[model samples]
Target: MMSKNTQADRNPPADKTAGQTKPRGKGKKYLVGLPITVWLVLIIIVPILIMFATSFYKKVGSNIEPIFNFGNYAKFFTDSIYIPIFFKTLLLALAVSISSIVLGYPLAYLVSRKVKRFRNQLYMLILVPLWVSYLVRIVAWRAILGRGGVLNTLLLDLHLIKEPISLFIYNPFAIFIVLTHISLPFVFISIFTSLEKIPKNLINAAADLGANGPRTLKEIIIPLSMPGVLSGFTMAFVTALGDYIIPQQLGGPNGLMFGNLIVSQFGYAYNWPLGAALGFIMFGIAVLILTLSNKASASEGYLE
Candidate 1:
């Protein structure tokens, strides 16, 4: 017969330590995330909520007085001035999106399929301008496109024109050019990532099945890469639409966009409610674009 002590030794007590460890780990994770959660709530969410609240209130004298009326929103619809600028902004955004997609797709494809070596080096080259300050780039463009600037100087020296052209700077076209140049790398990077995800064996199999280069790219590559294209377009469009600085600097009196008008309301106009309403409208449009693009991308994605 076994002793009482022997029976007790065979079965040790269940571990309480293991049970407590999971809860401790969870607590630690929450502790790490607390700062980020607090910061976002205080900075982004709070400000946005305040802005939304302020949108409903009217400006009384120098004070933002509270009112529950749809007059601000109503003005946007009835007033012809704001509506045209808003549509113009949308049109400009669409143009910028198309231009980015067209320019990015080819460069991304080249890097992914054709470049045998120094591929990363090429990517770094594309990213160099991005790392520099955005304001610096805008200023640089201003200098380059100015009447007596680099392009004109070169043209004048080469006897291409009798005088410097005033057509280059302080115009909508200049805004378009600068925005495209800066936003190009973002689109390229997104598309490049998508291209990299594609399997090499698919291309090889297509080739083995008697598919030519153009045929493989047409049916296989382009279909698979549409998501990246959509992403790039959305990014470019949103960035271009929300940019007040670019339009302010480059867009002349006739070329003033929706963003500038919104700024005017906040500045000397002193109409906080109106500005907030316009901002909300702009945000809503951007969100709508993103949502629609996402749906389209999702529908197209399953084919792969």
Candidate 2:
């Protein structure tokens, strides 16, 4: 009995330290993550909460009152001008997403699958625009689309017309063009990454089974790349939806987007409550798009 008791004391139990160790490790992990959690709360959560609360506040004669009401939200639905602009913005954003995908997918496919040499150079060229200032890119577009810009000069030199066309700038088409250019890189990157991740062995196997390039692409590559396509679509849609600068700069009279409307409420309109409501509506739409994209990505992963 004495020997057995001594042995038991020496061994104790395996779980004795296991529980302590696991909890200690978890506690350390939590402690390490605490700063990130705090940062997100302070930067993101706090601001969103503040905006949400402010959305319910009353805007009384250029000053915002702390009074809680649903007037701002109601005003959005009740206002005729707001709803039409919102729908128009939605259609424009959708068009931008489609255009980005159409333009970007070919470039991404060429870079990922077709190109052998100068691939890195091409990739860098694609991303180089992102390094430039956003406003600079907008200004560059203005310069190109402006009356005396390169297009007009080229057209004049070619004798396509006697004069430069004013149709290029300060129109809905100009807005579409600029937004597509801005969004193309993001879509290309997403699709390129997806294409790169496709296992070479799978393609070889398809070839071994006598599958042609087009068939393999249609059956395998395109389906696998759906996640990236969806992700890129979401990014383009969100970027175009919330952009006021491009619309304001290029949209002229017909260029007033939902984002411009929201900005107007905050800037010149002096209606903080209404602005917050509009901003939150946009934020919700972005969140919804992201959520859907994530789910689609996950579903694709599961199928793969």
Q: Which stretches of candidate 1 lie over 4 Å from their true place?
A: 1-36, 302-304
For model 2, where is the 10-residue window of minimal lDDT? 1-10
**Which residue pairs in model 1 clash with each other?**
none
Model 1 lDDT, full chain set: 0.84
TM-score of 2: 0.90
For model 1, what is the alpha-carbon lDDT of residue 111? 91
Local accuracy of candidate 1 as per-residue lDDT tens digits, 76-195:
999999888888888888888889889999999999999989998998998789889999998998889999899999999999999899889888898888889878999998899878
RMSD of each: 12.0, 10.6
- Model number with the top TM-score: 2
TM-score for all models, in order of appearance? 0.87, 0.90
Most lDDT-accurate candidate: 2
